[model samples]
Target: MSEAFVKGCEGLPWWRGAVIYQVYPRSFRDSNGDGIGDLAGITEKMEHIASLGCDGLWVSPFFTSPMADFGYDVADYRGVDPIFGDLGDFDAMVARAHDLGLKVIIDQVYSHTSIEHAWFEESRQSRDNAKADWYVWADPKPDGSPPNNWQSVFGGPSWTWDARRGQYYLHNFLKEQPDLNVHHPEVQEALLQVARFWLDRGVDGFRLDALNFAMHDRALTDNPPVAEPKQRTRSFDFQHHYHNQSQPELIGFIERIAEVMNGYGARFTLAEVGGEQAAREMKEFTHGQDRLNSAYGFDYLYADKLTPQLVREAIASWPGEEGEGWPSWAFSNHDAPRFASRWWGEEERPRAVKTALALLMCLKGNAILYQGEELGLPQAEVAYEDLQDPEAIANWPLTLGRDGARTPMTWTDSACAGFGSTDSWLPIAGPHRAMHVAAQEADAESILHWTRKVIALRNAHEALRCGEVEVIDEGGDLLAFERRHAGHRIACYFNLTAAPLALPEVSGSVLLATGDVAPDQRELAAFSALIVETQ
Candidate 1:
């Protein structure tokens, strides 16, 4: 959880420093033995989330889609995909969640829609159609090539030739997921209506997907070339991506969205901002209360390793200033390889994960815990033949691909890891089965139980929830800080390396401890963490 959701922080908004759980629908659970998770499955599991002490659950798109980009390409913004369930199931799921005191935040892919969407179908048929300019369209250059040199994040050129319209359309991702011309007033209104549709249906808020790419520079100018490219796999990584995304025009639309959300009671907004200018855009999109409630960057998601320097830099980005929008942090999500695999070797994984969670919960921003994170699930190994993510397939072995992170969540030691009666949409990692919910639930010392305890601890402390952070020590492999709220102060110390270190002598009552620590409180084992209440 971030620094905005303390249990006893009177008069403060519930979402200020709330902890949200992200559930990738297809891999979360399968109820009807269809090898895929559905709304019913998520509803059945709401109790687990509520028990975990999360403020809410953020469900990735379940809207009608063609499975291109796996639900990011929306065909119908209002309709739930049949594979997931119908609208009735969605309403029921919302009801169950509310019943369990959990807020529901659904993903909104306003930047683009599937090529099969009604608006796109009409717009692509001819330039004279009612929705002709609904999407970003341009003519070929005099040489009959693309109008600009912008590249798609998924690979190849961002523009695709359209025979019917005789123009090239922009797509920052899969060609099937056409970018929307958000600059158009009509397009912005249409998206707001989509938000209204969901808000009326009782969703607590939204997690805007790839929000920074929603608008592009209208001049169709070429993206500048990178001066120094590093270990590039796709052409997209070689460009500076200036004109292609993170346009200033985006802030206006974000304000418009925030206006609509303001009309609703306590509705929250979170943007997933990624790019070379992510830090800048994150601040821009969420500058004030009138804009997005908060935004999360890719600092931790794509990091090759977790270091004291990394934590220091990330926390420094947002100081929780008076008018500055709050921040959210995630160690693992559906898109990147799990942090357990990225940050530590097999021998240190268990203790490292525990300390990581303590660090995450103790941080100043909202914390987003992805499904299976509580169980210390690492990235699964999905063979090439079983791969499903488009970006991963395009880059092949060069990229780890997102499929490994999107594999089925382990529920039990039974066949299919008790995820479903049939084979899951993706195979379960063999090792994950041993760490399933059932096994961990029975073991009092398991990561799953520890996750609950850490979350509860955060909820019980006002200082940890929405406190101001002071970095006391970020030297070498040790990171120590204090979270201050009102008159209370809590000190958090972490040994990030794989070797024991002398503990920092701080006068305070012991609040929590993870990993091996000498009884005398003089030393901390590798990957250990200690939390102290100094006031």
Candidate 2:
């Protein structure tokens, strides 16, 4: 790698209190009039991303794949898919992003690869092959059934039969995304090679997908059933997922990845972890300086209501101190429904959106802003026939498909909403066109302006960036907390309910507010939020 590729930040930590704008490349922009987003398309929009006042951009997976799980199931790690452009386009995109002062972080799916991956194909060929131990393969039971009772996240047995090997291999998600055997030394080396390849290409960091699932029980034990019934449809929910994921050895592997990143200076790494024991495991994975820089769980992503109590509990769990891992919070993402539609109905959508944005920006840890969230876009209602996510389709009626959150970006009111010349890969209709980027840019009070202003405020305030949070009070629907650093303190308050709220007993000046605030008294309207700096 060139010196520039391994360049370290001068006296700065790449991740501390960073605002990362997440780009779902497929829905971000389109070039060549292909309707689907490509690397070149991202390069064209680098300026808009930089204008958002974020320190970096985290682009989701866009590697060569069969689109089985969109871009999560990688067939080629080093090369970009033809649909998303090739390696050259990715390099150009990286250069352009850097020129705009935006650090580029790409997704890395090391836990599994598409069955079409050459390693998986060769491993399944024969037991004596050079890559036979590349994937997590095992023999079946005497009854010709799966080795254990583990279940796939897509609603079936976790083990799938292979006609050639006459055995079953474990898969935590879809059958096509077979789990890799990270336990093997050779497998670890191969995965590291994939990371090094990207590092050589000048990518700043990686968002490791399913980091907990990278290791599993070597014995292939059956996971015990859950005591309570699950309300969701994923087959994996029936059990506690003991043998399938969150193995202790996963930390050692993360340490190895961290060592590689350390060699490259200021490169950052974050894990996407979620499960029954996710919070505990997340802390463990990032407890030390040698592990991942940060980890994010589903606490905020799956939350139905953003209450004061919920916010307090989530923040309090991770106290800012030495030896404690940092957190990356996200209210909405590509995998789940948008927070605007999920948290508030159409009546309170605009206020709730602004409040949510302010809360996320003021939080002490790193923040991830999902695509289209700045415009207060609601989840699109997709018909059954148009559904694409396998997890959603399998659990239809019970859980909405992720396609609703993966709709194309509404850039203009023109046909296709200025996303492309042709129809979008996913439908874009209803209130989406009216909430287009052009329309929002014309409206001064739009959510986009509120988001930019809050982000700027957070960036400008040192206390809001890396301060320690202390819950001041959680009375009624009012949430109040203090962010303090180097004797500087700022109080953040939120009226989560649909009613006016009086400020807590704190002598401070209102620094920022999502809505109008009375000057004489610290009063805010319903669903409002404010940040006040101490005198």
List candidate 1 segments past 4 Å from native: 1-7, 515-520
lDDT of 2 by residue, 445-501 (tens): 998888889988887776787778898884577888888876888988888888887
lDDT for position 249 in model 1: 87
Q: Stretches of candidate 2 above 4 Å error? A: 1-12, 518-522
lDDT of 1 by residue, 1-535 (tens): 3334433565577787788999999999999999999999999888999989999999999999999989999999999999999999999999998988889999999999999999999999999889999999999999989999999998899999999989999999999999999999999999999999999999999999999899999999898899888858889989999998988988899999999999998899999999889998888888877899989878899899999899999989997677788899999898999999999988999999999999999999888999999999988988988888887887889775489999998888888887889988788888788999999999999999999999998888888888889999847778889999889999898888988888667777778899544335878888989998989
**Worst 10-residue stretch by lDDT in candidate 2?**
1-10
TM-score of each: 0.98, 0.96
The Cα error of candidate 2 at residue 449, in Å, is 0.8
Lowest summed lDDT window (length 10), candidate 1:
1-10
